[model samples]
Target: MSPNPWWQDRVVYQIYPRSFCDSDGDGIGDLRGITSKLDHLQALGVGVVWLSPIYRSPNDDNGYDISDYREIMPEFGTMADFDEMLAAMHARGLRLVMDLVVNHSSDEHPWFQAARTSRDHPLHDHYIWREPGPDGAPPTNWEAAFNGSAWEWNEPTGEYYLHMFSRKQPDLNWENPALRQEIWALMRFWLDKGVDGFRMDVINMISKPWRADGSLPDAPVVREGFLQPAFAMVCNGPRLGEFLQEMRREVLDHHDTLTVGEAPLATIAQGIELTHARGGALDMLFQFEHMDLDSVGGHVNGKWALKPLDLRDLKQTMNRWQQALHGQGWNSLYLSNHDQPRPVSRFGDDGRWRVESAKMLATWLHLHQGTPYVYQGEELGMGNVAFDDIHDYRDIETLNHHRVATTERGQDPAEVMASIHAKGRDNARTPMPWSAGPKAGFTTGEPWLRLHPDHDSVNAQRARADPDSVFHHYRRLIELRRQHPIIVHGRFDLVLAEHPLIYAWTRTLGDERWLVACNFSGDTPVFECPAELAGREARLVIGNLRAGAGERVDDLQALVLRPWEAVVLRLLD
Candidate 1:
């Protein structure tokens, strides 16, 4: 057997600190709230807790815009509260992974403040600054991910700075050796404080392409209203590998920690190089290919418009990643995070067969060969919220797109609202439902965002007590990963890759083989054993529903599956 690291066998749970739990009734979650909820996470059987950014910020892009990396946000708590929370998590045998937002810092950060004051400042080269175009327009025809131009003009300085995201965030220049050392020192400080790992946000965009004379030429415009695509030059730049390898040699080599990069437009080949064990770059990367299967116009249209998802395309995308990275690297499996809508609402049936569909998705993702990450509230089958009006939306991305679509594009307000309702980041940002009490047991005061109304019927308190709840189903899946080594190291083979409604695959390790099958739709589908395992005896292992005494068939025959039903069986030779 190949030796595996501690993180390889463990599961990660991501917690958005602002919406997790509120302890002081301040309408926002705090560090003390996270400390009080350690027992809940321990009971859920997750080994790693990946917390979103809790650092001092201006709240422009939630917590992603960091003003101070060393200090905790006053709303979240003080340094003392962070220490207490970290101690509590370690005491419960749970590892903590912090979100590293070094791709860009808030405009209010000390480094940026000093860099923007004058051209001859000591930290002037810390951020990317450029002169206006020949026509006195922005530096380049590049657009930010959150809409608008990528370059923000500084009236006091007479130069523009680059911002791939919002204007409040200024991109850091990794080409500066002193700035790189400063980041290394900050990482060492956190490492000494006992942080187990880091979830690097937009780490791929740190190194940007620049001309020999430091000139940024305009990109080819693709659309009329939209700016040219800048990711081609911003992502996976020339010096990315050098910077990551240098970081590994300086700060990460002596530590036993996990690192995952949030790569937005990375391809499979890029993922392989970034995560290769010998490359010394990162442990794994979160690619956005599978997430865009339902997008109407690909990356340009963003996630606002939706289209029908083709099962064949989905299977091909996932299979390519699994096969390419089989022995060279690792994969991070997930369906939803703070940036996207809920998986149950987007991919599965969230209305009538919510429970079954949730379990089916868990089975389909966990049975693959990789490390699984469970977002908060996903285990309980929590779904998207229904907001009728645009006023109910609070996400900056959603509001910005709504305005651009309605006012700039002359689209109907009702049509924009419908798209926002179907695909909005706020769908995954609602407060976690702890109980049936007011505010869904999230806070004593008004929540930062509204709670889902269905929390009354679907919550932790009720699910924990019921034996047949989605929470328990997830627990069983986690246990299986811990007990079966094959689930972790087995070779993946796609089965029924072209099926329209049913998804199936197999994992094999020497003499042992396991089959995982699921129905994606509400209609009953017929499942047939593949020809390769036609004569093998099938033994029922774990399933969503228990089979009767005579219901277990040993021969390869046709069997009908219920809506969103998932089953796992071992084939004995």
Candidate 2:
């Protein structure tokens, strides 16, 4: 394998189409709206743009439940708009990677629609199906990610079909060779249309737990009255490696495309098998170990049990991936996505030091040893939205959790709202703040989802105009990765690991050693350089504070950082 792939040095920016911009002003973001903003991405210095699903869907999971593989969702625009968007991206030298949601298809999809008709239907095997118990009960105690039983009763067929998510989305049966071919053909269709690659949604869940008797097994109940997450029964199943490798061989191998899968509970060792550079299944994998640091109790209770972000635990988790995947596999560095809360609100201060903490967090993630991903509005420092009323949220996951928690578990409504405020996916689904103008400049009419409450203060116009805004900071970080090979291919070693208020690390590429430090709290923290960088000449690559953006000669041992400050210095011999 070559030392540096093109993807390794470039940054990937994600855009949830519904929240980006509304071109038609019908209250939803569309494909043309994305085409209009190609300049924003080119200006941001991201090489690749990862678009969330714009495929035909019932929107049960906010486009995660795909209904048609060949057509665009009418709310998003037509196929012509998609073609225009892709061409516009390429014209600006930007590559577009579409979200591929093959783990499940909407029940409205033709295949599933036909499959549910009867057991004798030709497409009956297209989706997983099973007979109910003797008394006509659900197949197992497994729970849907959105709530209720994993198996939904199909009256026409007199059987239950598997749906790990919403019942509207039935899990596709990869066990059927014909169904696998159908998926590959759809992938080829997009590739032929000039798409650069795919960001596979929950690709690990394509295969389910199967017993020797050819039946899906039930997961032991962990929470007494509640159904288990069934994570063990759903993710990284036995045939996962075979399926991924086959995918690479059949379709991905033919094109120079970026392939990344959403791996929910994948360990570092397993992550290597799926992404090893030579003879590996994928170019990279988005692992969720680090994302779990601040939470416990998986989706059975909507994972609403919130915990404070522990910097040390984060430090350990990140460094583990860094060391483990250094050469064996690859890593995709991201702090937040459409499925997670806004980074600033979750990890940094969204109240007093929004800008400073936003930059700090970006600096921390981008300087790591992998390709970095930037979620929409992250550069503008948009924090999470705290919708006081549950009616405002459009996310199925958040809505389901709120409903089940308040009614079934008898949890307090206010407490449930607090959890939603902290970890709800709706926080990331809010419309992007393009301007301080009315409607946040996202739409001309009522927005499909609510806009950020502070859009007036935190908009792209405000950020781009300010030299010290988080937007410019992110741009400069991307510039650094492009210009300096060390930032992309360096070895990582964490420093000040025990420091509660500071998260600092060193990166080395041959003789090039750099010190990257971040103050993770609201209080000022003093960070000392590692022994090797104690007296080295300091050249500032980037920093959050305006005064520290250029060359510096401060003593490394007593360097003082302001609240939520971050800096990266190239130590010269």
Candidate 3:
């Protein structure tokens, strides 16, 4: 058997294709645009590039609504372009992992089209369809992830179909054996092309709650009249484990693949079971427990209901995962993704302490025991865009929320806009600021979405030139991980667990030990070294402070840290 997949210790960089770079002058990013940026990935020291969906799509839900499983999106380029891109990645010693969105398919897809045309169609059972209730209401009071009802009426079929996301993206019926076979075939199609693996989008949501009598249970009402979120009604359903295991046997077991499942709302024990090496379904899991800390009632209020990030709460969450997954499975570490706002804006200070805070966040994430994911533009200390106009936003989720909040709920538009500015997914979808030129050099033509106004100050061209840029700090962090085996296989223990602003942790492997500490605020904070490490000789392996990349100290009893200052010290015992 393979000792461990190469992706175990490699850092994965996620590229949101549409906003990464636009090479065709069509104002949209394509395969050629991504190929042009291979050198950047190589220099950044990331081993794997997780390319977002480029499959044939209708652009509804921005390529997540896949219409054709085997073809590339015309706007993104052709099948030939995909092949060339893959070859270029391999030549540079970089592995490519494609996003696997099997939970749903575009309404325009042949199967969905045929399924919706008539109730007697052979493909009708390929999707989940249900007769309306006696009052002509939807089958269940289940809300889609984006907004509105989870069930959409099919006029021709005289029934409503399930859509956990947008109406155009209908959820697939996994209970069908034929559907499973077809999915397995598509998996082979890409793996045969030599791509590394898959990042299953909402993989746990495939096996939704289906009763023995063929009825989907109604979601519990959070409020009196609103259609409640179907998070519990559909997510992590009974057959999730069985389906994943079947997928492994049919597709993953045949290839040396790297599988990371997006398992929202999963507990630590569930994560461990899903990613177990022997009988498990995936190699890693993206848990949202840490991401949910700031949101009070996330499923009910959506992500817009924001709260301040408590360093102590963050420490507890991370410590639990790190300590639990030490030997059972692996963690997929990330601060933000394509569907979330920039980390600098959310977790770190994006204004007064931008670069320092970005570097500090990177240090905090990479210092732990997990495969770190660098979303596109994250390494450059990019922050959220201040799009004052709702027209400037492009995400369906954001637009839907604005409509519901203002028109339906009678909410103040300005207050709603503030929430959008804080938690909008469009914040992460801004065009990559490659240079401080017109359109930030992302495109020679008009960009599909408005570029961040601050792109002039924060761009890759400038960050790469300055040694103190967050880009270089990330490079150093990745380099350290590659060089030190302890960083990958070490056990983590939280220090100063109760500190409100000072987040500190230690990693140990046999006789080797390393201390990592960071001040999460603008105020200077002192990290009183732990008793075991106090008075021990230590060298600053890497730091975000202005002048301490390799400084040494004989005694480590107490050290003052600047605002957002982060330090990694190799305890010389």
Candidate 4:
């Protein structure tokens, strides 16, 4: 409604610390490494950098299980290094957004240690603790996101602690006002230290109160092959809005900072209510509906079919969000993040035609109506890493799922492995392909993890030299979005929704109108332009191939598109 907000025009880059760059030659990425790369990030036109968890941790969940929220992890350097990184980022006109994992804390944290020491201790109430059932088993049938039961037996306390994730990371008791205040104080500390904002980790899950009665307030939905119904009950609870609003009032709203919640399960209605401009809660939230586009089913453990999306479905999904949040909230749009597989490998053709297909995918998504987020190595058209051995894995969730499907669930190991092959963390977490050198130039040693073998051919060094590479295409895309006001503030409208392979939309802001069309299928698709968009002259702004200028499809005329080809047109009155 108003002029596009600063965030809408900016490109946010996600950096997973461990695999980004190793400064000290220890095979682990650190703050100094990120500081050293500020110029490269700035050159790419990134306005904000979202760093994954770098807080003090046991590395059980690779920094997600924070032991100390106030301190940086030793492996990632000290708080001083972080401060220096922040200053350097500011010098480059880039903002730093740190991960805030308030939903849980590492078991080794002082609060958890004190809680385990004595039942009467003041810190004992900081985390969720419930009495065991009559059979001395877990209090409820709630399942952990990784695998089996959510509750872990605590012998010292003679009770079970709630861990929606790994056992080493216990969920905090947000129902306790004192604990909530402490979290607020931590937020204030970070903001005082010059953090632009926070990328809230599982921020919605922090709302659930531990009920000793083992009965969730809302009924659970148990779909076929779907195990975690507790996710629905715990995520986005009744008190979620209240908690987020308090957070905004105490920390984010004060500085007018950017706060994007990692709220994958939140509905569009909930997102609008929480992120509306009138200081509802967050600036935006990441939804996984489109991110999970190629999956075989909605279930995480199922095999991925690599199915190309029906253009109509993609258009409807985007239209639903755009229409819902038109004037109320904002959007954080992305194709690849740390937890998911690489976009090019899963969505685009990454074999012989990697560069072309990758660029096409970039054009189709980044030019849409939302703030763009580029995960590390996405610029290089990086694909999923292939691993033949179990030792090649570094992610805890992947390992746990492997064990569950093969051991407990009694499924064929090959079939389980096939699912993992299609979708695995190694897809997004492989070492950044900096150059065609030892360790893909990510490290001098044997790397903390396996580097994708294709790094030799798909490194940034080569992409930077090629004008047609996906990396350069991203640069052009960012520049175009940054310079165009209408693309940022314009209203989104779906133009053609009946075709299964042709997705077309238009953006209108004042006198400027731009039409974007894409072919989601591998075969060429055609669509007839609506009468409302019929015009005598429309110039081709951009396309997958150099179709040249002055190409116009008048209203009522059918336009044909090659497989995976996308185009943008400028309407001239």
* Number of the top-ranking candidate, with TM-score as the measure: 3
Runs off by more than 4 Å, candidate 4: 1-4, 209-228, 296-308, 547-558
lDDT of 4 by residue, 270-372 (tens): 8888878775678889876776555555544333334555656667777899888977888778888898888777777778657667777888777677788
Using lDDT, give the best candidate's number. Answer: 3
Winner on lDDT (1 vs 3): 3
lDDT for each candidate structure: 0.86, 0.88, 0.90, 0.80
As a whole number from 0 to 100, the lDDT of residue 22 in candidate 2 is 95
Task: Write candidate 1's Cα lDDT for 1-573 as tens digits.
Answer: 124778887889999989999999988988888888888888888889999999999989999999999999999999899889989989988999999999999999999999999999999899999988888789888888887889999877899999988999999999999999989988888889999989999899888888898887676756775445676558888788899889888988878888999988888888889888776488999988899899876776677777988988889999999999888888899998898888888889898999989988998888888889999899999888879877887888888998888998899888788778778889989998899998988899999988888989998999989888899888888888888888888988988898898888888888899887888889888886678867767776677765421235476456567899888888767
Model 3 TM-score is 0.98
Query: What would the per-residue lDDT of candidate 2 be over residues 1-573, giving only the tens digit for each residue?
Result: 245676888899999999999998899999999998889899999999999999998888888888899999999999999989898899998988989999889999999989999899999999999989869988887888777888999999889999988999999999998999999999999999999999999999998888888787777766677555865578998888999888888998889888889998888988888888888888899998888878866444445788887899899999899999997888899999998998999999998999899999999999999889999999988898888889998888889998988999899999999999988998888998899998998999999988888989999988889888899999999998999988888899988878888888889999888889899998877776668667667778788974765677568887888999988988777
* Candidates' RMSD to native: 1.8, 1.5, 1.3, 2.4
Model 2: lDDT equals: 0.88
In angstroms, give how far residue 345 of model 2 lies from its true place. 0.8
What does the lDDT come to for candidate 1?
A: 0.86
Question: Scored by Cα lDDT, where does model 3 land?
Answer: 0.90
What is the TM-score (0 to 1) of candidate 2? Answer: 0.97
Over 4 Å off, model 3: 1-3, 223-228, 546-549
TM-score of each: 0.97, 0.97, 0.98, 0.94
Which ten residues in a row are the worst by lDDT in model 1? Answer: 545-554
Model 2 segments beyond 4 Å from truth? 297-302, 528-533, 546-550
Clash tally, candidates in order: 0, 0, 0, 0
